[model samples]
Target: MDAVFVIKLSALGDLVQADGALRDIREHHRHAIITVMTTPPYLRYMQRCPWVDLVFVDPRASRFNLVALSVLRRRLHKQHIDLVYDLQQVGRTRFYKRWLFPNGSWVGDVPGCSCYLKRPKGAAAADHFAHHLRQAGVSVCHTLVGNVGWMADDVTSLMRQAELQPGFVLLIPGASAEHQEKRWPHFAELARHLLDRGYRVVTVPGPADLAVCRAIPGDMLVPDDGYYDLFVLAGLAAQARFVVGNDTGPTHIAAHLRKPGLALFGGHVSALSTGLQHTCFSWLEADDLHKLPFAKVWQQVEQLMGKDF
Candidate 1:
């Protein structure tokens, strides 16, 4: 194919998981112009991906916007794409085949496609994703590609301004607000413990995390208006001695970069699918984030770091 398009428009964690598929696509068509369609929030990070050559941001104006779909159709038609990889095998993407971009070699569950992935019964999400690529004739391998470097200079600038050194511990204390169960309660305490142990703990706080940020000890570093985008976070994380985070996007970024850390997953998330496949990473969890005490998580962090903190 001269031109290939991939669609995975939302959910930051899932987008990170699609790294392997993107890598497979790159390997499958080395010279093809690979474009990805994603939501506005993820476009910047997706643009950072080395496999994709271009990015299309879906405004997602509203639910079922026919006008927007028409504009999108016209826009995609301009690309003369030879293949469309629907990584998001949902009803919305199915609509793209049934309605908008109706004529194309789309590799998805939809009919009239070059290939289809009949998801194996009881397959894990990661397995299902990989299976989809393999069924679509793309070579699936264990390569990850999440590198936009959107703020390399900014990360360095901000770190230098803060007088922060490398090897500090990064703590991500927030999760999707809709899933309150995913937010762990002991991060502040963990920060305290790490601070007492002489490890600098830093966290970039969202508005939802202000309370958690304030609850931590004064020693913990919280960036003021740093605008820590994914690449910047990845850059800082790359230098960190350890990263501890809730099962959220940054945790996935850390996992993608294979950072040694503890991903605190609650019972709500499937560890097998979302857990970092790299051995350097580990996870600790309980029935819920509220129930998962600090000690259990600390033990896992120690194990990940290969020493007592």
Candidate 2:
């Protein structure tokens, strides 16, 4: 393939899954130029990833905006895209594909899964997208590249500024608006456990996660304007010995980056949402968590910490 286009718009976790697919594509077709079409909020993340050759920000105007659509159509034609991967697969994105690349080979969803409020099964979105690619003749497994090399420098600088110590744990306790149910109150309790165990704790929150960040103990270090960049946030996560979080985008990033961690699921989303990768990690159901005492969580943490991971 000379060039390919991947369309995955918003929502952090799904976007990260798209990145994994992009990595596999690059690995398989080293000479192909890969372009990713995503929303502005995720443009920065896609730009920093080495697997992608270009990052096209989805137009700010509505998909129905004819003028903006015309401009995009012209741009795609100029780029000479040979194949299109529609990871988003919404009706609007499908419309854009029809308009922009009438003859390009299309791969991905017809319209991806709705949010958990619709209560879809917990399958990893990356695997789901990969299945589509396979049906279109792209042979690859769903593997996570995580965030590496993308923000190595920024993470090092931030760690120096924060004076981070070894054996620190990262606590992420936020999710997007649609995934709020997946987040639990146990992050604070987990932080306390790590602290009492003589480990420093670093908490990172997105722009809207201030309330969750504030709930962390005062002793724990929360990034002060440092995590504005997604790559840097991933790097910070990499520096930690392990990460503990609800099923959110950063948790997936940590998993991809090879950071040993535990992902707490509320049963609102399924294990399918996160590819069932076997490693030094644990997945706990929200109801199961409610039943288990605090000691069980600590035990799981210790068990994970003891492994090679």
Highest TM-score among the candidates is held by which one? Answer: 1
Q: Tens-digit lDDT track for model 2 on 1-309?
A: 588777878877776656667777777677888888888888777787788889888765677688887887787788788777676766677677556655556664433311111113455566565565565556665343433435444566656777885557888788886766766766678777767777888886777677888888623344554445566677777678888877787787777666788888775666555663633456666554445456667778888887542
RMSD of each: 2.7, 4.8
Residue 302 CA error for candidate 2 (Å)?
Answer: 3.3
lDDT of 2: 0.68
lDDT score at residue 10, model 1, on the 0-100 scale: 75
lDDT of 1 by residue, 105-156 (tens): 8888786667777555444546776767777676767433333233233467
lDDT of each: 0.74, 0.68
Candidate 1: C-alpha lDDT:
0.74
Show model 2 residue runs off by greater than 4 Å.
Answer: 110-122, 139-149, 177-179, 218-228, 276-280, 287-296, 307-309
Model 2 sits at a Cα RMSD from the real structure of 4.8
Task: Assess candidate 2 and give its TM-score to the true structure.
Answer: 0.82
Give the least accurate 10-residue stretch of model 1, judged by summed lDDT: 144-153
